[model samples]
Target: MAQFYTAKQRVTTKQRITVTIEDLDPFGQGVARHQGKTIFVSGALPGEQAEITLTEDKRQFARAKVTRLLSSSPARVTPRCPHFNTCGGCQQQHVDVVLQQQSKAQALSRMLSKEAQRVVAVDEVIAGEPWGYRRRARLGLQWQNKSQQLRMGFRQEASNDLVDIQQCPILTPELEALITPLRQCLRELKAVKRLGHVELVQADNGPLMVLRHLDALHVDDREKLERFSHKHQLMMFLDDGSENLTALSNNQPFYQSHKLKLTFSPQDFIQVNDAVNQQMVARAIDWLDLQPDDRVLDLFCGMGNFTLPIGKVVQNAVGVEGVAALVRQAAYNADLNSLKNVSFFQHNLEEDVSRQPWAAQGFNKVLLDPARAGAAGVMTHVVKLAPQRVVYVSCNPTTLARDSQTLLLAGYQLERVAMLDMFPHTRHLESMVLFKKT
Candidate 1:
């Protein structure tokens, strides 16, 4: 008898609402309120009024897409790329480049402050070229049955449909120029149906392309790929989800930073933006205040990007990576650079690393460049090493905040924090924070 009545479900009407954007969320979505609930609107900016149609509605917040713009912000500008609105590659393209960096920096500072439960000041935003800076990209390939053509480009926002792009302004000139030619070559290839994805990298040597296929190519298809490689003067490789990289060209692919050349395979993970990467490395070294006789540890070291550079200045530097191949490559790179004092170890950082022999070594300084998951599990073991200084480079702020809380609780105080605009015009945020043991 007490539970006789049942509450009716609230119906969400798909109606357009006009609201003034008050702020920008971390993902560059405009924040507004409707019916006492928060709503995030895409393609809308702060201090602007727009008519938005709700795309999603939840108990706490809703998501919407801007259908009409009643007013515009002074910070708004025309996007440079023709596929800006359709392509999912870049967000915040309509906002001024400088404003984009500032917004990201502010967002990061607020996040860190909240996480640390104290006021945190953000240093000047480190930025580079806003366009044509992307040196690496994984392009999608789709066979369009309706047009009897193969579409090559990034996927549309929130859709699997590929945005057939002739050229992407964000890609380096060398890589951008290959788009049309690569498309044509793929269309002519007999192995077109087996194609999975195409990767383009503007290496220090030259443009290196990797064609991923589901199955092996025939002799004729291989000959065609060779011809394409020769015509474009590009180093090419073929990958079929195998560990080995089949070379299509003899030319080696490499990149340079901090006066060191790093040779890598097409499948290797390297920073896409070289300019920002160099700056970030230099700043990391400067902030660490490396001593000539000090020992340093570089965790999640990929092919010695930070490891080799730090090794050059330190008495002893040890690089640790989860991948065995990367660990071997790190050692090779160290040797290539004539860095005799560097060493590398292969271990899974997410697991218990305290038992590792290298973990017992004392380190005065530590540098962590972890992926989005952050170095939470590794931090526990790292604390045992008791490094005097720790510098964390993070691509995702949420994880950084979580890890920073752990570091703070472990008697580390944040010294300096800065944002690196590694990927401009996108919601991705890269930040570096220095922590000193209290």
Candidate 2:
């Protein structure tokens, strides 16, 4: 079937309207009500008046971007990044950091309170330096055929287009200094057309680099990358979209959490904010109130971030991960730390875990740091395990609230919840929850 649009159905010019910003929503957009319809205004802050141009329209709500700010909020701050408006790397840089934390904490509390069918408030907020705290970043590459130039930066807001950036304010100082030189180096490569993206990480030892290439690099291009690595004195890894990563240096990158060093490959997952991560680990351990005779089980334990620390204080610590590679690395990290009481196991938490060898043992204290999807498949098993205490570290609050239902129904209490200001100047929020069977 074919359809044709009539004159009435033809595209019309954008609609602009004036509205008073009421509040900031979960995604950091300003909330406004216009003629009884909910309007989400971007680049607008609470307690501000603005003229907005509609970007999206629906029956119940509409999305708009501010064209003119007739008024501004007292909490508004000047954004540090020049690309902050166009780049999608961060969203809340224009808003005050303290207000950002307050808004997010309120939202998190409401979400958890509703999910748990009881009042749940954030007991504490773990925060650090609002800028230059990020230890990891991935910049995209867009190669221009006619100009033979490679534009390296983050993606544009809500688009695939790259926002060419000289430096990002959120990245650590070490990684930030390499951005211009890295862009220049990528443009110098003969295999620019095959370039994918570049990942930078600020390890405790030094900065690290990873280049994702669609195809194998030429001899000269590889040498050029080597020279760049040599000049910066950072470890370099070339990823060909596979498990086999080509390393240009023998040095391994490592980071510290709870005073334990965790060695990981460029492929492994590590927290982007080192300060918040360390504080978070300490808080979780403190909340658990670990006893010397107790045992702890860490779910979704990647490279033994929390598991290694738990091992030091408990009689035994068992770390479980779905990825075999991470499990192996977690075990190696424990061994490297000389923690003989710690063990790592690889098992899919989505499946029946009672049948697994690791689940046969009794774990009095359990800590699970699942990804954004949350531990839906393992919540029942976690409840069944009958752990006296559980510390859940989550990157997504909706999923955290969703999974907390099982714990609540199983007679566990939401003791303490903390909002982790892990990624400032962004809508992304991380949290730590303590559930104790008291």
Candidate 3:
């Protein structure tokens, strides 16, 4: 008879185990094997030996927290963030930055090769400043009853407890400078208890701070926020459970890429890293080898981030998005930029959209920038369009690999691929790949 063990029973049985780290998982955790079972250990790097305590035990694999570093890897470095050990915002800060990029690129290449069943050569690793590149961040807020103060910062690693950090190195200097003043302003608000989350964005025009609250702010609270905005020379907005955003200041928040303007709402999705995004958009345009007469399709296009820029060079560009609001904004951006060749349509790409009018329009090139849930549903319809080239921009390697297999099966050959270091000191990997019809 086979024996089974509960998580507690297994931990009590093993207590602690020392093992050599073999490799790293996509999340940058050290991978090790013990007693014919896989163990994932945090804060341990490849080529290191560590003693770990089991935190979770499953039938297939177990999760552990490193207790002692028996042997340290050469590539390991002291993390710069003072709260690196506690803050959950970053993962690879302990590893050397160059080594982190190389490891990520290798992992991405391996995934693509395994999924597509062909040798995938990574062309280049697109990288920029590793720190202070993040232009947007959402911070958690909590009232400490004992101190009668508000705790503001990111959450703890793997826990919901907010880390009271005074400054974050990952955020742009303009946004980081407001951390202290923002906290002070929140403390003065009578509706501070109603505060849910704080979002800070460094738009191209200026900095914008958004305060989300579960309840409406009092008149005094709004005045306090306005003062803070004026003092910091930043725009302020309030979201009080209403679907619309109420501006406390007259400034509008927007960002520019490729000489094109893009206005976004406080809650709308935009790439957090500005420099990396510019390079990514340029690469996508170059890889498509777009021509004056070429018609292009951009799937999951958000607020014309890529659509308006690509529309400038192509004969006609069509962008499809799931959210109608974003589609409306994209169209507005096209008209704002005087790009008449671009058009946007609202359609849920997760379902069959082959019957949609835009789907029937022949496009010689297609660009995909889907969320972590890759573009599987839209790929079938895309195949029907038979675009000559397909460019895939992925945030999740696992999903990218899954969708790559689908594309390979549809007679598309994976030609060029690269990794973009969009989020440094983090496990998140942003990559781009080009597929050409054989």
Candidate 4:
């Protein structure tokens, strides 16, 4: 007996067509029109012709992959990394960095302008060295049973698989040099099967590595890690998925920003680009037009990146953060810098802070750097606080545009907006804006 497949039970066939890419979107996808419908091609660039295969079809638009390139754009450059196509680390490797920044800036301007109901021009696009700027990275680790070896690198794109990267060009030279030796050490470990992931960071002091494991390590394996750390002159830590860390060495890990030395653990969050961050901090401080008598409030202030610097120039500064660990670290950082005028508080930003002790003292200037979700409800508080100047730093444009309406309605003019090329060769966009009371 034979079975016949019905239309509903059959898999949808892929549609292939040739189209001209007219524009590039913020996500690094190429925009094209085919048969009166918009098509998004992943690996295609603007002003290029290519045959594409439709992966997803919808009523208004479709997603596609480039099959063959009929023509290439002048801006196209050969990717430096061998795993650029397969590794999910970077998306715009094929395109030059300058063009990449231009496209993102245009998208940001259009979105911010549309949301503000007025033409908003990007004052400047803050960019730094295109490559070797990523000071921190997390390399995924997986042990292959059949092969009896360890695989290390970034995860594969659109799949659970991993790409064994030999060289990552985006990492700083110090960190990239440790990749081979680090992998070899882990592969030789007796507890390799329990290995989870390896985090690499290059601090100004030295390189630091964190090895996350699911089980305990044998004494011999621990000795090997210590020897490796000593030989490489880097700090190493072992994590069992907790705040407690077993140090393999005795040196503290710290980085310098705006001439301030801040100590952070291996698992703590810090900006990956050191140069851009320092420049951004200088620009933000200058944009506020700081005065001698201004009392400042810094919200979502992770590790006192801005508050400590602001405190040096202002009368008093208060930094508030949601994470207790970060708040403690920020306060420690303030003391380390000998900044007695600055203070830190651990409070959830979503809740009203009017009753808090820190809120009793009014703030004339404010700064907030929120995650991608973009600080909602906080804008209303800012309005009530009636700060003369407010600085909002954001990583997601969609949320920034939505939140801008709140401040605009509160009679705060969007003074200046600058796109920060924090992560080059990737689609991540970070920007900061200044809002002044009308």
Candidate achieving the largest lDDT: 2
Q: Please list the residue runs of candidate 1 whose C-alpha ends up more than 4 Å from where it truly belongs after superposition.
A: 1-13
Judged by whole-model lDDT over C-alpha atoms, candidate 4 comes out at 0.90
Better of 3 and 4 by TM-score: 4
Tell me model 2's lDDT, rounded to 2 decimals.
0.91
Q: Least lDDT summed over 10 consecutive residues: which range in candidate 1?
A: 1-10
Distance (Å) between predicted and true CA of 184, model 4?
Answer: 0.7
Residue range 1-438, candidate 3, lDDT tens digits: 999985764434657999999987657888999999999998888999998999899999999989899998899998878988888999988988887888789899999989887779799999889989999999999988888889999998768899998888989999999998889889889987778999999999999988898887788888888888888898888888778999988777789999988988878888999999999999999999999999999999989888899999999999999998899888988998999999999999999897798988889999999999999898888888899999999999989999888789999999999999999999899899999999
Candidate 3 segments whose C-alpha is farther than 4 A from its true place: 1-14
lDDT (tens digit, per residue) of candidate 4 on 67-177: 999999998999999999999999999987888888888899999999898999889998889989999999999898999989999998787778988899999999999
Q: Give the runs in model 2 whose Cα sits over 4 Å from its true position.
A: 1-13
Over 1-438, each residue of candidate 1 has an lDDT whose tens digit, in order, gives 476877999997788999999988667788899889999999899999999999988999999999999999998999998999789999888988877887788899999999889989897688789889999999988887788889899998889989989889889999999999899999998878768889999998899888998887989999999999999999989998988989977887888888888988787899999989999999999999998999999999988899999988989999999989888888888888899999999988999887788887889899999999999889887788889999999999999999998889999999999999999888999999999999
Q: Where does candidate 2 clash, by residue pair?
A: none
| Predicted structure 1, TM vs. truth | 0.95
lDDT of 1 at 286: 95
lDDT of 2 at 231: 97
- The ten-residue window of minimal lDDT in model 2 covers 4-13
TM-score of each: 0.95, 0.96, 0.94, 0.97
